[model samples]
Target: MAKQLIFKTKYTEHLKEAVSSGKSLEFYKSKEFVYDKKQVLIMPNIEAFPNLTSSLDIKDDFKTAVQIYEAFKGLEPIQASDERFWTYLAHVDLFLYMIERWPEVYVGKSSNPSKYLLDHWFISSSAQSSLLRHAISGLWWSVYLSVDEAKGENKYGLTKILFRQLDFPTRTLGTYKLGRHKEAVLGILEFIQENEDLFKTKFEDKTRFVTKHLNVVGGVKPIAYYDRQFFKSELEKVSGNISAI
Candidate 1:
C-alpha cells in the first residue's frame, strides 16, 4: 500500500493548462512522469491504498468499477468528489489505462483532444454528471451507487444491471436529476432487473422513457423523500409505456 496523494491545486490548474495546450501529450506516454515535491500533498490519517494497475486488457467497465471500488472503498463522498485526487490518478496511476481505453484521444485521432482530455482526465466538478464523465472516478461511483450491502453475495446484481450498457449510466442516469438520489437509482435499476424481458429489447428507448417519466413525476411529488421500493412501484406504473417505447 502507498500513501494517498492528491495534486496540489496549483498543479491541478497547471495540468489543465497542459491538457489544453497539448504540451504534455508526450508525457502521458511515459512510464512515469516525476512530480515536483511541491506539486502533490499526501492525505492525512487515511490508510495507505494499493496502486491501480494499468492493464490494457480489462475493457469491461463493470469489472473495472468493482475493482476500483474495492481498492478505494474507504474514500468518503467528499474526498471521492475532489478533483485533485481524481486528476492525480488519471494522470499518474491510471494514465496508461486512459491511453489504452481511449487511444484515439492520445494518438491525435480525436477531433477534440483538448475536450476529451479535459473531460476524461479531469474531474470538472463534484456534480454527479461530472463524476460519471471521468474515466476513473466514473467506475468508482458506478459501483458505489449500485452495490447493495443487504443483497449479501449478490450485492453487485444491481451494478450489473446499471453497467449492462454504457448508455444506461451516461445518458439515462447521468443526464437526469433523479439519479442524484441513491434510492431513486436503486429503484430504477431494480425495476429493470425485475423485468429484464421488457428491457432486453429497446433498452435505450425504454430507459430513456423511464428516466424522463420519473423526472416528470418528481415535478409533482417529492420523489427524493421516497425509498427504492417507492421508485420500483413508480416505475412499474409506467412499465407499459416503457415497453411500447
Candidate 2:
C-alpha cells in the first residue's frame, strides 16, 4: 500500500488539514494526510501518461482519463457543487500519484507541494485555462470534450487536432456555453476538422468562434437539429466575422 492521506467523511475539513501544512515534494511522501486505505481510486496505469502527454492527440490517453472520470462521475467528489470539485481532485493524490510515478513533475525536486503541485492542482477560479489548470480535473474535462467530439460525424478523430492546439481547449472547455452542451461540442470540432486549411495559420480563439456562432444559429433553431452543412456554413460565417471583431 502506498503511503498517503485520504478523506473519510468531511472533504473540505480534510482538505484544510492537508493544505494546512503547505508542504511539497517531500510532503507527498511524508506522514500527514490520514491514509484511510479507502479513498476514491485514482486513474490506474499512469506509467505511460507522462510520455502520452507529449502526444498532441491524447485520444487513447483521453480514453484512460475517462476511465478515471467515471470513477468519480456520480461520486461525491464530482457530484457536489462545482466549486467544491477541487477539494476532491487535490485530496485524491492525483498530484502525488503523478509525482511518485515521475519525480520529474517536481519543479525543482524540492519536495515542496505548495511550490510545484498546489498551483496547478488546486485552483480557485475556473478560467478559460482551467481546462489545463488543475492536473486531474483538466484531464477529465479534456476527455469529456474529446469524447463528445469523437461521437460527431467526423471520421478522423479531432482529439489529435484539438489537443495539439492549445487554443481549442483553453478558450472554450471551461465555459458553460459550449462545453456543457454535447451538440455544440461535436458540431464545432467537425467544423474545424473539415476546414483545416482555412484555419491553418489564421486561428485565434477558434473555440470561441465556434461557440459564438452556435449561440446565434441555436437561437434560430435547435442546435441538435442542425446538420453537418449548417455547422460548416455557420462556422465559416463566424470565422469570416472574427477578423472584424
Candidate 3:
C-alpha cells in the first residue's frame, strides 16, 4: 500500500477553519525535516515533513519547499492510476495550505485564493485531472519536469517566462498528456521566450497558439522520441515566419 497522511479528510475543514478564524500560520506550523537533496526523499510521516505554505522554511524560502516536494515525488513510489493520488492527497493538500495562506512567494494571486482554490483542491475521482486541482502536487510536478533538463543543460530558466504566461503554468504544468513529451513543451516554451520580442499577444492567446501546434504535432508523431532539433523545427513551422530571429 502507498503511504497515507491520515488526515481523515480534515483538509477542507482545516483550511476552512484556518481562514474562517483569520489566524496566523503559527498554529499550523509543521515539524521541520531535513531534505536529502537527492533525486527523491522519504517521509513516512509525510504530514510532519514541513509546511509548504509557511513563509518560514527550515532551509530558506518557498523555492526550497518546492525542491523538497520534487524530491519527494521520486521517493513516493506512486503508481499512475487514479487510486494512487488518493493515498497521498491529504499530505499534499495539507502542505499547500501554507502556500495558499501566505502566497506571497508562491500563489501570486489575490489574498483569498480559496474562492478558486477550494474547487480545485480535489475534483470527483479524476486524479489525472486533479493535477490542476491540488496545489502542491501540480506545481511540484511542473517544476520538477521543467527543471529536469528537457532541453539540455537545465532549461529550467524557461519557467521564468513560461510561468508568467497566464494560464500556461496552470494548464501545462498539471497536464501529463503533453508532459510525456517534455522536449515538445520545452521547445514550445523556448520559441515563445525567444520570440517574445516579435509577438505581443496576450498570454492566453499565446497559450492557445501553442496548444494548437502541440495538438497537431503531438498527434502526428510520438513526441517523446524526437530530439530538440526536431521539436524546435515543428514549433518553428507551426509558429510561422519569425521576422526577428
TM for every model, in the order presented, reads: 0.92, 0.57, 0.58
The Cα error of candidate 3 at residue 153, in Å, is 8.9
Stronger candidate by lDDT (1 vs 2): 1
- lDDT of candidates 1 onward, in order: 0.80, 0.50, 0.48
List candidate 3 segments past 4 Å from native: 1-48, 55-73, 76-118, 149-155, 172-176, 241-245
Order the numbered candidates by lDDT, best leading: 1, 2, 3
**Which lDDT tens digits does candidate 2 get at residues 66-104?**
555544444342432243445444544354444443344
The predictions' CA RMSDs to the true structure, in order, are 1.9, 7.0, 8.1
For model 2, the stretches where C-alpha displacement exceeds 4 angstroms are 1-6, 9-12, 20-26, 29-97, 100-105, 109-119, 123-133, 148-156, 202-204, 212-229, 242-245
* Candidate 1 stretches greater than 4 Å from native: 31-34, 48-51, 54-57
Deviation from truth (RMSD, Å), model 3: 8.1
Name the TM-score of candidate 2: 0.57
Q: Considering TM-score, where higher is better, how would the candidates rank from best to worst?
A: 1, 3, 2
